[model samples]
Target chain A: MSVSRFIAAAILATALILPHADAGEVAFSERRSGSTFMAPETQAMQSNDTANPGMLGVLDGATLWGKTIGAAEKSCASCHNDASTSMSGVAARYPAFDDTLKRPVDLEQRVNLCRVDHQRAPPLAYESRELLALTALIGRQSRGLPIAGGTDPRLTPFVDKGRATFMRRQGQLNLACTNCHDDNWYKRLAGSAITQAHPTGYPLYRLEWQGLGSLQRRLRNCMVGMRAQPYDADAPEMVELELYLMSRARGMPIETPAVRP
Target chain B: MLAVAAMLGLSRAALADALRPYAIVDDAIPLSLTGADGDPARGRAVVLLRQNTCLLCHSGPFPEQRFQGDLAPNLQGTGSRWSGGQLRLRMVDASRLNPATIMPSYYRIDGLQRVAEPLRGRPILSAEQIEDVVAYLATLRDQPGKHE
Candidate 1:
């Protein structure tokens, strides 16, 4: 017999004996942070503040916080007065309900809203270095704290919408966010480990991107990978998804300015 | 697991025409996709190809591979478990069997949304490639701990 035929025969006789699991939700006690899936060196990079490149954005943000900008000539420091004291644990509970908008707004959106309402400044562009720096600074204050988002009773509907989005199959690939992140966490996709979709790290540095980015950016990237139409940057669905992710990661410790491969 | 160049006597030029329509009979597609038997050797190569994204979600008897996904069932003994026709329908589109399946419909084009610009209007696999993979899967019939 030809080598291919022999191998084929061997494979056929031994199929379907492997065990498989039905799709379901991951339990809270079993939840894992994304860092657990990274290489030791990469994890070390995130653990060491000096070695972490995201800290550079935090330093820049510190400078911007005090330097007055915008028509109001007021800076983030003018009103908030020391992010360390006031903003501590703020990021951990974001994607919070907004009474004015009748919807939830993520940390980034809140920053933009502050700029619009108080600073009299035009909202910074998404993924802009300044926005990333500020968010990185704010997110860092919440590092080591447990995520507490999606707790607002008013946010129930938005959170539900976000969960639906995560579970729904979309795009040409016909996959849902839950398909890989939920069912295949700890599995390898090509060469990379598939981590659970948690929002523990935000304004985090990704080695592939070589810069800090928001959770929305990551969500859009996944949609593109699914061969699906990504939501617009300002879409409410983006905040909704972020809200749901924060809730899903309810008790996981925050790892702002995190480094990921 | 050496990669084999496809030699199914077919070409991209041969697939330029519209997708060949096939009727599903109950749970199977009982006709050759390219009107010819596919080469099992070439089909095996397609399964191992990284771009196909199969190994990302499945494990098989390929000992040389260091990382294999555990998302889906193991690919061993597929031939014994499923008929060639059923496997063909699956290769073309598994969602017909289970709507919530994470598997991509390799030979489907319509109803898919927001395909990347470069891949728009094209199925994930060609007719020949699908046939080749089906042929290769059908050869995976050796039972575990009871190899023939």
Candidate 2:
């Protein structure tokens, strides 16, 4: 082949290899779940249900799903019986659009909404153990399914708002989420490795926290690390950010109750 | 007259606890916070320390360290790249220059929100520590690291 023809072929190959490097998103083929960056021990802990501490929350959730509570005298089993069948693939499409509130609500918020609106029960507090357990339980049903968030046309504006939050600089550090997760993922920050901020493992167990926590808890921790003020527990901004992150991991597998460093 | 003197003394005490005033001239704070030059040895200690969070995002000329970071520019040759006054400004608040830097404002206390309760109302480093870090950084006149 002619030298110029060879050069042309090389250029085409490079384009095919790095399709999204310049499009401001990680390429489809290059995306990795957060678990890929964990140490072998942590990975093992997440894979084994008996060994995983997050499974404790799932166990608690199983009990809560069946226990009768509130004035309506009903359990979650009353409406959504047999979660393994009813809740399957439900979490994969969450932080979904809510028509009544005209915005997005995460799985935790959805659970609380059900308690308040249907069961006439008071809303669960954010980060409460019961909420984590229920979310972990429901989220477990979607384990291994691909995420399908941010696909609704109604969520376009909220997703854009979330993306803006991800890109905006704040705190004394003046760093945006992109500066770590988007620009320098897989790099080391002191003793810790920075992973892509995927929302695949909500209500996952973090070694530092020594308990299962929601994605909002982790996001709040990062903001505090940046020396920035965090949003309120039930802030719409938090839901929007969760929605956007789930959108980013659209085709990635869910690992609810995942263990992490 | 006695009451007036007591009020004046109280205000003076409050001023002492606040940040030292420094002027910015075209991207630099040309005066020392403690009104004296800092010790380079002490400055080196501050840079290497983990609580100061410098090495968490910056790789420098220290050959003995195993886990330096790559989030920011290499610290080698920073002495030649910038003046001491410029370094002071960067250490105090890098955002004044880049507006989007991940480097924390080591000596700034205002305009920050939701700082953890334990660290509220205080700079990340003391005035003397900032000066010491500037002094150590000013001595870093070596060539860029191979990792760069």
Candidate 3:
């Protein structure tokens, strides 16, 4: 056999095994997230907790954890008690199925539900400072743990919905999520490197925004870039897409309160 | 990247000028496009457009442009390699050649999913717009000393 043919066979074998491997492991570990592709100065910000502006969100979230709010006058601490213990690893397992909701709900949505139902307080508005802070605090607890959840049979339907949305072309630009993060994640756009669309470091502080925002905010930004009208903050489509993203990011470590450019 | 983005935004105002109807189909690499004369100046505008998003996936040799994408081939010397007809087909639709190409069809609009309401049946670029881009790209023959 020719050397080229032997190399081709090896490549073909690996491609065949990729799907089964992705089933339980991290999606595209071979392809690094956008974080690894950024300039050194930007990466440095994500590394040092103090230098990371998203840390501000974390600090503010800590205050919200203790302060009483809503008509119930209850705080996140009242029931969950010391987040480090109760919420530990919880963020990693999000986009989990909620029996009451009967559909998948992301960590942000879950928080809002708790605020309205358990705490008797109004749900924080999407991308609101309070919402980002609280989400970041919870996410901080799961730092370094692989993103998890979506294994249950109940989640399969929503995962399919999310996958369809990801693959489907949208907006005036006629671009899909796969067009960038999947097909061209390693390629450069202008001078910026495209990272595989992992949801690892969300509720992250972006240099462009100069503020912290939830993953949904980032999704909305992408939608607008496609010239598509974005779904509302609490839309079901967002939840489904989040579920699909979480499943794909199954084993990537959480990097909440992350910084980005 | 930001500087490149600004330049693209400013130059794109030239893309939607006057365009006549034209159909693009698959046959050869540089498909024949004799219906209307190609316009390099207008073509340059389409490729540099931010809203049109050509720069988002491909790069080319344009003196005024600062940054270019590297996802696909560089368009610097395409004219020396393929004919205008072939370029027209690519502009019309790339999937005909490689069923799995990531390149978006600049002129094909059928069977698309999730297009904006006002642009449901419209091609990404009009026929005359495609001709302009083809004309511009054809002028980019391989020049030894042209690139730095």
* Each prediction's fraction of true contacts recovered: 0.48, 0.45, 0.52
Order candidates by lDDT, high to low. Answer: 2, 1, 3
Worst 10 residues of 1 chain A by lDDT: A13-22
Off by over 4 Å in 2: A1-23, B1-30, B61-67, B80-82, B107-123, B141-148
Better of 1 and 3 by TM-score: 1
lDDT of 2 by residue, A1-261 (tens): 333453465457547753432245666777898899998999999999999999999999999999998899899999999999999988999998889999899999899999998888998999999999999999999999999999998999999999998887666565678878876776778768888899898899999999999999999988877767788988888998999999989989999989999
Q: Between candidates 1 and 3, name the one with more favorable lDDT.
A: 1
Expressed as tens digits, the lDDT of each residue in A72-116 for candidate 3 is 999999999998899888988888899997998888889999999
| Candidate 2 lDDT score at position B68 | 91
Q: What local lDDT does model 3 show for residue A225?
A: 75
- Which candidate number maximizes TM-score? 1
Docking class of 1: acceptable
Off by over 4 Å in 1: A1-23, B1-17, B60-68, B74-83, B110-121, B139-148
lDDT for each residue of candidate 3 in B1-148, tens digit (9 for 90 to 100): 9999887655443333322345543344343344758677777877888778788768877667777777767887888876787777778776655444566777766666666655555678777788888888788888833321
**TM-score for model 3?**
0.83
Instruction: Write model 1 residue lDDT over A170-238, tens digit each, in one string.
Output: 777878888888877767775678888888989899999999989999999889888788888888888
